[model samples]
Target: MSNWLLPESLADILPAEARRIEELRRGLLDLYRTYGFELVAPPLVEYIESLLSGTGADLNLRTCKLIDQVSGRTLGVRADMTPQVSRIDAHLLNREGVTRLCYCGTVLHARPAGLLSDRELLQIGAEIFGHSGVEADIEVIELALASVKRAGVQHARVDLNHPGVLRSIIDSDPALADFADRIHELLGTKDVPGLTELGTQISGVQTGSIQALIQLASLYGTTGVITKARSVLPALPALHAALDDLDVLIAALPGHEFSIDLADMGSGYGYHSGVVFSIYAHGWHDALVRGGRYDGVGRAFGRSRPATGFSLDLRKLSSGLPAAPVAKAIRAPWGTDAALVDALCKLRAAGEIVVQMLPGQLQWLDEFTVDRELVPDGGTWKVRAIA
Candidate 1:
């Protein structure tokens, strides 16, 4: 006999954690409903082409690929469900007006994205398609914040960004091309020394633009960050427009603590083309929620629609919750008594969990916190709290 060993970053979720995950899943979906977002479930796997059509393009290396047995085409285990949801919004639903959709499911990755991570993560998110405006961005951002609150997570901050700002600067300058990747990396870390060294290497690249770009790395915190950026960042028309969009977002999010991070450059997947945002809890290094405007993610579906969405790992949020309310059961002994059967059915129908204890299953009753027992009370069965 061979011993079974699970792959790295793959493990079974015990009952307690599973329960919490399920609870948060329901909590998040319920929250989306209040905003009129309809829930949709895409498949766990799909044709490689359609699966990687939109944001999935950024997830090419992350997805697990296999040949489809029936169609002889390639299939991919979804690395991200946002692309699939976009497909639904474009082809299946085909609504001309704005379409808001939410989904919860497990997405499989070829390998763990981080040192301590899972290959399969439960992803929950909401996306709005067809509206290309800062209003959609605000709605997604607000929903992201509301999701954290609903998950019982406290003291978290959402850092906002417009990757287009930095991207615009890179694309506009030919000298910045070779050093683009390194500069973007350095900027994200606020590495002044690295930027200085690199800037010194690129001769005659306009000291003003280089200095302004370096300044962006340090520009974060409050609405003042946007004001500061407008003054420091290069006066490119694209940069100015992106800053204006930032101002709108800041004004809309008054009283909500958020910081600007122009150097973020969107998610690791790089699908975000407009406003990008990530939420980080007080103690956690990783963002609990990440999403943004990928306005044309549905382009591959033959119909381009503006899209913005946010997704988080339910398993991660589950652990952050204080506790899950476990269900208590009423233990009913095995019997043919009409009174007992009717009592059990009625109790179950009324939403009270009644567990019928089989001959040898009495021990299992204790496992579910069986706090009550059904017993005969003057010829009528009644429930009494176990003492």
Candidate 2:
């Protein structure tokens, strides 16, 4: 086997793609900063318990675990950064008022999320803690929309759902309790036949619950689906509250297209407590952004706080965008003379790309284009257009 061969679903990002990903990272982080979100970076690895706290089983399956050399305790490479950020907000910062935080880091997944996904992701996101209102949900959703827009994604749409709606219905019948996770999976794929099989196979499963699951499958479309859900779904207050939450978000964010999927569970993390949403654009096969209200994820850290936030993989985001333009550069010959050194410093300080050539070095730059040259003209260095 070739030594340079990488594992499936993992590949090294070369100069062009790496530069584009970096640019997107900087722009998104700067955007988060403008919203008053203070940046935070959690450790790349932590004790398994701390890393997996308050998240779903899916995250556990994705996390790569190892033995700690010092304590012999199990450690986990984080597959998601949200829980780690929650721990920080709850234990480290411990602020009493509404606290906004942002983070950018690399996450390792044990397996690829999808056919086209890389196991490694550059995850970047912003979170709002200490506020549980629909207002906080609105703010995060707006920021998520703004993020893809800042990345030049057009025709973006938001699909909203409330896991509580389905969760309440499942809770209404005790027989469905043990199969909750399986039911969520079936509903997520809108697998009506799979759900029907579940109804026939499970002992003591309620006929009404199975019927509601089937009905919920088709309850995805425009805002009108919310009204249809009320009529079709069981008359449970929690279910209605979930629908109301989606309604409020739609009202709060007018002029943006929205679709409601009552059956859609969530990001599989299972911590979302209120209105959850995904941002989708045309070019991407999957969602560009995912976020929502997760008010109690901090409980495991001994301090529960109302939190809402969203995150997206910068690598995935960069993959769908148009290719980044080659950076223009002023090619200069290597020299230690005071005048040449000063000229190079001044050009760099003035925000110019200056590539100094080494003796016998090849001029190969896929990431930059030498559009001009720095040369000695009449005992002074001058930048002239390259011919």
lDDT of 2: 0.92
lDDT (10s digit) by residue, model 1, range 93-117: 9998899999999999898888877
Candidate 2 Cα misplacement greater than 4 A, ranges: 266-269
Q: At residue 194, give the lDDT of candidate 2.
A: 97
Error of 1 at 304 (Å): 1.5
TM per model? 0.92, 0.97
For candidate 1, the 10 contiguous residues with the lowest summed lDDT are 360-369
Candidate closest to the true structure, highest TM-score: 2
Q: Identify the candidate with maximal lDDT.
A: 2
Alpha-carbon runs more than 4 Å astray in model 1: 56-58, 177-179, 200-204, 266-270, 362-367
Question: Worst lDDT window (10 residues) for model 2?
Answer: 262-271
Total colliding residue pairs, candidate 1: 0
TM for candidate 2 is 0.97
